[model samples]
Target: MIISRISRFISNFDNLLALFAGACAVLAVLFVLFLPLPYSEDQLYPKEIDESSPLYPYERGGTPFERADIHVQYPENSPFAGYVTAYLTPFSLALSRLTPHAGTTIVAHPGGILDEILYNTRGLDTVVETTILFIAFAIGSYLFRKGS
Candidate 1:
């Protein structure tokens, strides 16, 4: 809805869509890799389940075994972990079942140094260049519009 205001400020819906798409693509990659969610702190620096920790079920504060559920504060010990473990456990069973049926063939091919660098970097340089180009295109498209 806010972007609708830009229609009057600029011109051409196609340019707006291009700008929106470019911005969204940049944000998607950044959030997936670099941006940390609020639970990231808890996930990274999980407190030990000791007397000093809030997760400790002590007689002084928290009841002992009164809560039969695994708390989300300890993500590693949560039901989600159990679910993921159960899901992946089938893969190992399937692999074991299929191992004897398949022929064993292992091949290792070394890639070039340039290819390795591009693979490891994931073309961040390309992303940066594309982002600059997108910004420039949006600005030019708006400024060079027929009316304004």
Candidate 2:
């Protein structure tokens, strides 16, 4: 039937699918490695965080994720800064599911290469994004092999 023909036609493109998926995965990782996520101070830390109080997950150096700095803040001077940030770090558009700050907006800063490298070093965002992309690659490979 037509459905069977369509299925076979799709299966024949498995290799192409795999290649495209792999390339996308690599690009996603690169973006994460070279993008600085924009976050507010409250989003980066707990609302009641006390750096000098020595409280767990609240004090300075207590959180596992990186802190928000001026670089990560949305530029007030530019009206299109938010749009640019969201566009550059599209992966962060996902709903905030990480710990410490659940109700926070996550976007990437349009920073230089060095800024990207330094900002991503201490956060779990890059790791999470990379993992998701890796999973996508694995699934694509599996499908490709299954069709072969």
Candidate 3:
């Protein structure tokens, strides 16, 4: 009877883990569709391009500045959100490279944070990767339950 109770508890714990993965997958998808990651960018050609400005090089007709399209930021009030975005960063970066103009690029340049979260989410690549991982984890969980 003790062995049976222990096995049952383990099974329930496994189920909970699967549920958590599923929830995370759904959250990632929803974030891609609705959650707005923040970003800040200046116009390429401002009326007055200062010597210290990034566009200064381009203003002189020198080699074009090489940089990502966008730089994203997390809310200062919430560190968890930042971690999630960081986790998605790898997949988003790879996708950005595969499609240069896909509009999900992130740069490390320093920029002021805006009080808006109405921009684009990380990227669909993050959703795809998370979903795939969730599916694989669910399948593995099922197999483990079946085997035991």
Candidate 4:
């Protein structure tokens, strides 16, 4: 009788683990599907400059077009800036999808603040996805073990 009880206990444990694993797999798939793609209008494309255009000289700062210069300025405290920073990681990952040099730059000069944001955001997303998948798998493993 003692031996039978021990066997039953072991079986129960196995069922729990299986349920957890299944749950994790399901959640991982769902997250991958629902996760949003990151992007920004300003950073989406390279700024265009025409040699004959008056704004051409001001592309890198020294120009009569003050607003154009200011547009590229990084405002770390701004809400938009925060969003940009938060999504930097995702953006970088997205970039990598297109090319090999996605997250290669440690501190993208002049774009440091934005780059930091992107890196941090990507890190956060990875963590969250990992956690969700882990939990889902745990639950699925548990259920499977019990059913077995």
The best candidate by lDDT is: 4
Compared with the true structure, the alpha-carbon lDDT of candidate 2 equals 0.44
Query: Residues 16-81, candidate 4, lDDT per residue (tens digit)?
Result: 777788899999999999989676666631444434422222122221111122233334443243
Judging by TM-score, tell me the better candidate of 3 and 4. 4
TM-scores of all predicted structures: 0.20, 0.24, 0.22, 0.25
Worst 10 residues of 3 by lDDT: 110-119
Q: Sort by lDDT, best first.
A: 4, 2, 3, 1
- Candidate 2 residues 1-148, lDDT tens each? 9999767766787667876888999999999998998865555212344333312222222122333232333345433322221232333323333333422233223322223333443346777878899999999999999967
Off by over 4 Å in 4: 1-40, 44-121
lDDT of 3 by residue, 66-144 (tens): 3222233443443222222223245544543565443323322111111111212334556677889999999999999
**Worst lDDT 10-window in candidate 1:** 103-112
At residue 61, give the lDDT of candidate 2: 26
C-alpha lDDT values of all predictions: 0.41, 0.44, 0.43, 0.47
lDDT of 4 at 104: 32
Give me the displacement of residue 105 in model 1, in angstroms: 33
Give the TM-score comparing model 4 with the true structure, all chains together: 0.25
Question: After superposing candidate 3, which stretches have Cα over 4 Å from the reference?
Answer: 1-122
Off by over 4 Å in 2: 1-118
